[model samples]
Target: MFSVSIKASSIPMSEREPIQSSMQISRTTGQGGEACLLLTGSCTLSALGRRMGDLSDELASYASDPNLHWDLTKIDQMDDVGAVLLWRSWGGSRPEYLSIRPDQERLFSRLGKAPPLPSLPAREPLWIAVRIGGGAILLWEHLTSIVILAGQLLLDMKYLIAHPARIPWREISANLFRTGAQALGITALVGFLIGVVLSYLSSKQLQMFGADIFIINILGMSIIRELGPMLAAILVAGRSGSSMTAQLGVMRVNEELDALTVMGIPHSLRLVLPKVIGLGIAMPLVVMWTSAIALMGGMVVAELQLGLSYQFFLHNLPDAVPLANLWLGLSKGVVCGMIIALIACHFGLRIKSDTESLGIGTTNSVVTAITVVIIIDAIFAVIFSDVGIR
Candidate 1:
């Protein structure tokens, strides 16, 4: 096969082709002493090319003279682009002194009837203050809702205490199995891996200082007093809290929440209270289990890296971390667990009957629960700083 070669032009776009432009404009004095703006040659897009801006500017200058005669009839071949340029130059209306052909007259008429473009509104000066106020109002609304729910729970709690038969033991048990029992495997794995990493890192620092035995104290105090509860709470917030919110959101979509309302069953009594009580009971046990698993992992790592025996690590654990620390960790679990459940239910109950609301509500529930858990942890750290650190 023989190939036909076509060499491309080496000339730059801005530098080439404008030299042979056909469209031209010139000013001439008319017989009546008025200036005549004459346009000639092919007044189309292909002909104008890079010289369009220059032509538009010259046309506008001639248009400014109200007494000037625009003679576009001289144009040899005019298209839509040429018509638009002429129309715009004449200030969206025909010049007082003008001459045009029938086809060109139609183009001007169409352009005259076309609507003007929409413009953007001016921005407000106090937009920042408005945004801040809106956010503060939303926060206050959420806080108020949460406080109302807590008070309702307290009243229901008193009622249940007096009439033990109406207690939602079955619902609480079901939630306990879901939030606590089903969560163990993942929590154990996470705790063990965390312990191993902490032990490995701490071993290096202790070994350098000739204080390898201090690994037990570091792991024991930190894991039992802080890390264990916080880790479990965060995991549960993302997992079970999201599940709870989504469950309620789905119920709202399916009209089950409405059905329950019509059937004389309160949402708090049947739904929210059980989840709160279940998580409250289950959280401490989970914290304890997590702490134990992490300690076991740390013990294994300490023995492997520092030549410390597992028996020695276990034996000195009680003396290294006080019993009060374990209790404090469990207490944090209880508070965080209830707070997570409350946040989840609050978001869930507010979900509208739509898939978009369901998705947004579930996401907000998990995020708010996790954030509230961290905040609770920080508060506990500050308040009980002197209680567990010894």
Candidate 2:
């Protein structure tokens, strides 16, 4: 005979019982006869409390058996909760050979009753629609503010032109130097790489067609007509536009703008005009620098890969790209810079008296500037295509 035994300790009546209780199980097997379970003492609420581990161990021993015979003959006391725990441990469904003492029949009956399950509330389609509609309204309001600001900028152009002296020259110069000169090194490196890539790619395709010499024309046209203006504008917009929005937003939140107005000072002339003029002057110069560096990069690539002389590359550049193309790039840079400054100022002025509004204004400036740049580029593309510039 093989047997295992476990004993549970008594729990206190005055104090609350622990969440789990211990139990002892004695198993006996004799001469290969069906294994027998001897469950003793009370695994009850008042006695053993909740002895889940003991019950689980007892059930696990009989898991591989085809038929389990439980001997509850010596149980002094049992409760409905204990009966339910046993029933759950034994695979839930009633076994055909379950043996319960006559005294514990009431406990078994209670365990058979099912507890009420929680009910889930039904979802309402109207509530979902209302939330979606509210979000749409908020988006529309933001878009409307952007449109009104653009309209106001257009109407103020005549006023700006007439009062050119009202623009703060010193502040404009400071901002131009900060936004343009500080970015020169990185812009030159990026422009150089772009030029090198264009030269190498064009050289390969041109060599295949026996037109390798025209690689200069390809680099010149691509840089002067498109890459130089677009790249410089994007870099300035990302750097200067965010800074302008953040600066104005801080002023708006701290009530400095209001204070300036109360002191009879023109906030627009002091703040907005300087930024607009600064960017307008700086952007074209940045574009010119970017174009020069890009051409140098292309010249280096041409010399290394296409066996072309640096002097030859420089000599062919003027004929390959016209002065008209350089002018077009400069005009694009000016327009893009004005758009970035205008959008940044407009969003900044819209900030509320909170940090959240400041963040929103800064983000809105970048998005608006980039969108305007793309739209203007598309317009230029259509115009240039019609004129047969390519």
Which numbered prediction scores highest in lDDT against the true structure? 1
Clashing pairs in 1: none
TM-score of each: 0.69, 0.63
What C-alpha RMSD separates each model from the true structure?
Answer: 10.3, 11.6
Per residue, candidate 1 scores C-alpha lDDT tens digits across 200-298 of: 999999999999999999999999998999989999999999999999999999999999999998999999999999999988888999999998889
Candidate 2: residue 195 Cα off by (Å): 1.1
lDDT (tens digit, per residue) of candidate 2 on 88-160: 7766655555567654665576666766577887677798898899889977886787677656555555666
Q: Model 2 Cα displacement at 71 (Å)?
A: 42
Model 1 ranges with Cα > 4 A deviation: 1-127
Clashing pairs in 2: 6-24, 6-25, 7-24, 21-50, 21-51
Go through the candidates in order and give each one's C-alpha lDDT. 0.88, 0.77
